[model samples]
Target: MKKLLFFIFLLLLFSCKKEIKETLDNNYYKKARICRDSKHSDSAFYYYNLAKNEYLKINDSLGVGNSLVNMALIQTDKGDFYGGIESSFEANKFLRRENDSIFRNRLATNYNNIGLAFHFLKDFEKSSFFYIKTLQYIDLTENKLLCYNNIGDVLISQQKYGLAKIYLEKAYLTQNSTTLSKVINNLAKAKYLDNKNYDPLPEFNRALKIREIQKDSIGLNSSYETLSTYYLDKDKNLSLLFAEKMLTEAIKNNSPDDRITALQRIITLDAKNYLNNFQHFNFINDSLQTARNKAKNQFAIVRYDVDQKNAKNQILIEKNFQQDIGIILLALALAITILWYIKRKKRLEQEKEIEVKNTQLKISKKVHDVVANGIYQVMTKIENQQHFNKDEALDELEFVYEKSRDISYEKTDTQGEEKDFSERISETVSSFKNDEVNTYLAGNDSGIWKHLSSKNKEEVYQIIRELLVNMKKHSKATIVSFRFERENDLIRIFYTDNGIGISGDVIYKNGLSSTVSRIETINGEIIFDTKIEKGLKITISFPAS
Candidate 1:
């Protein structure tokens, strides 16, 4: 009873310790969020790093991912674009690819921030690629429109005006008032860039008016800069006025990049004060670059320290991982062995079923040729003869009956080689001819049958007999012809009949299906030209060797 009480106490103690650690981690995360909300980015990033480290101690991957994403966004805002991209990539390593909406939102935010950083760095290709990645995970309609606009902006930077317009126009149609001015500005820019004669002043002014009414200072800076650029070639004095206005708004917004851009425009348009504007440009540009460099280095150092701590933790993880891996590998090997055994057994059963099916098909073909075609041949002969011989017809019918009884046994016909094959074919066709039908055969020579194997000859003999049977039964033709030629390594045969033609869609029936199967067994091709107006024409060809 004492031992049981001790064990229970220990379990409760461990659970309490875990809960306390999680509470501490949550406190750090809360502090980070508070700092970020108050615009204390540096303090927020520091707290987030602490939160991330605490989450790592408890193996809280989602917490780690969230902290890293916030860190990346701060770095991007501070102009450390390379550092931001690195941090975002590292966050993806910790984020689990679950279908949870929160996870997807975080994933999209990470990729979109990466795209914004790359855009600022002027890596338009990478910017566009990451923007597209954002689109895949972002579910919100507003966020998706923003991604499309980002892609359009990248396209515009690359001078792909037509493609930029495609995305901008799509975003414009669905944009709310918050996004309307931005979309319209980009659309107008694409139009003006694509066609030199396109007057973009009205659209640009409309966008500017919307921004002014919304009191969007950052947007106002953009509008003023665009107006300055538009009039630079057409009206220098008006362009200089817009440049001065842009500089004033950029200063009010504390946008260093915009201020530098406006300064360059003023130096060109206001030549009298060129030196003054140039000096101001150099100072702000140099200071901004210096500040950006310092932030980049600081973020890099933070990431490097985190990596070092992770490396130390990984050493402990590796020892336990190796032990687990041995057990896993043993289980995997047993599973693979069982799977392979099952697959092999299934394969053997499938092979046996296929062998049975092939044998049945062979026997069925024998029945059709020996019994069906034989009976038809005897009937044709009797019907064509002027003086019917009862004894001869009875002998032929008796021969067919004997073949049918022994059909189950696969007996090879060796008698085919003993007789002249050409004469046999000629005799078969001649027996089919009657007062109503005239049949002709050409190239029925012994030399043509010399190179053919006994199997090939039998298949060919069966195929010819099947065709003649079909013609006698269905084709009410007055004339039929069969032409044969041996060219180099191939034999070609053409069969034609002047009767009511078959339809364009050739359906093999009345033993014609079996005839096709026979020809294919010897690697032969047969084409039926039912398109002919009068009767059917078939061309059969096969390799000789």
Candidate 2:
């Protein structure tokens, strides 16, 4: 009977422990939801941390990942981009391990959220890369509308308006009741950027209708704000009406960004009728500033709370380790310190090397400015001297010009000045073209030549002059064309001669070696494609400034 009583006691103890755990978990979740709804981010973060710890203790991977994502959202809202990125990455790692399709979709959403955080931080390339990755996974999932809209937003931020419009349109097409308003609003924004002013009204009206039907104050505010701006030129009365509505909703939503945007719009519109709207504009502007200051302070507090919680957790983890283990850790730490010192020294040396390169560039700029300019002036004086022998003076001038050209090339030889180099080449080529060659310069006017360092200008002139000389000597063709354009930050100079084109095999033994050497000196690349009947097409890419 005593043994039976002991078993009953053990059972009760285990059951009570489970009940207590469940109660804590449920209470933490409830508090987190309430805090988030109330915009009490610090309280939400605290509850989230409590829930996350419990989930981690129970080895609940999905629960832990979910809590981490929520914490990341709070971190993002608080403008802690680095912390948010770390949290999102951690969430993604856990979610990836879970094989469920629903969890995989959640992982994609997390990636998109991380991209948004990076976007806010002005890390556009990383934002675009991650958003694209999210889209790839989102395409295979049921949450297509959300994925499309987010991808569109990322593309828009990247200033790829054409691509943004495509994705936004797709989102609009696939959107359901939950996503319709947002998709429509995004579509309207994309359309406005695309310069489709005539059709934006329909899209904005559609989004506004959906927002009104759903009674979404934030969505309604955004739509109203956009409409006010759209109609400001067309209908002042309607614009004022919409602007007032936006201001009211923005205040109700307690969104400082929205309030600022609405006020700024009203101020701009009121400038036409300054006497009537001046008071309203001033009042809104003051309120907007106050709201912004309060939001900034609240964000700071949230960040501090998050940091404190993380510090406490870290301290707990450290305390759980054994004393002997700590001694071993100290030894390991010393070894790591030595290695880190060596790595840091090497890193510093590399940075010094980069500094040296930059110094060289600055020296080059000075040489071009002073030495090259002085040489050119001397050359001009020689050319103008009537008593100077014509052939001898020309020879002296050429020599001086060549030296000036060499100095300019040395100074501006860096990759950043290649586009300027290409434009100078094009101008030189155009100058050399006479009635005989019927030379036509085609391609976009880069205007990059205007900024070329003296050194780059000289090299470009010599290169183009060499090409023209070659064309005149070897090519028996009637027409020659040179085009200058930039593609992917590389300046492309295309030289085509209608004259008799030589085979690449034949050119291997000719002036090709000198040409190749000259291009390689400035880190420029060249491609030559020629047919027996067709003209030789020589394409060269130089680093453009």
Which one wins on lDDT?
A: 1
**Roughly what TM-score does model 2 have, to 2 decimal places?**
0.46
Error of 1 at 193 (Å): 0.6
| Model 2 Cα lDDT, one tens digit per residue, 1-545 | 00111211222233233333333445676788689778787788778766766665555656666667777767665556677787788777556553564465556656766777777777878977876776655534335565677667667667888888888777776536536676777777877877854477787888889888888776787688778877788898789889878878877877656666676677676667665556755776687556545655654565465444553343234344564676799899999999999999999999877976986878777667766776777668776886767786666656665566565555444444435544655565666567676777777464645454566556566677777767777777678887778655567788887777878787755446657777777678888887546778898888865
Question: Residue 168: error of model 1 in Å?
Answer: 0.8
The ten-residue window of minimal lDDT in model 1 covers: 1-10
Compute the lDDT of residue 462 as modeled in candidate 2: 64
TM-score of 1: 0.53
What candidate 2 gets wrong by more than 4 Å, as runs, is 1-34, 37-39, 57-59, 78-83, 96-98, 119-126, 136-142, 195-198, 232-238, 272-545
Q: For each candidate, give its TM-score against the true structure.
A: 0.53, 0.46
Total colliding residue pairs, candidate 1? 0
Off by over 4 Å in 1: 1-25, 306-545
Put down candidate 1 lDDT per residue, 166-257, tens digits, no spaces.
88887886556646787888899999999999999999999899988988777777788788889988999999998899899888878888
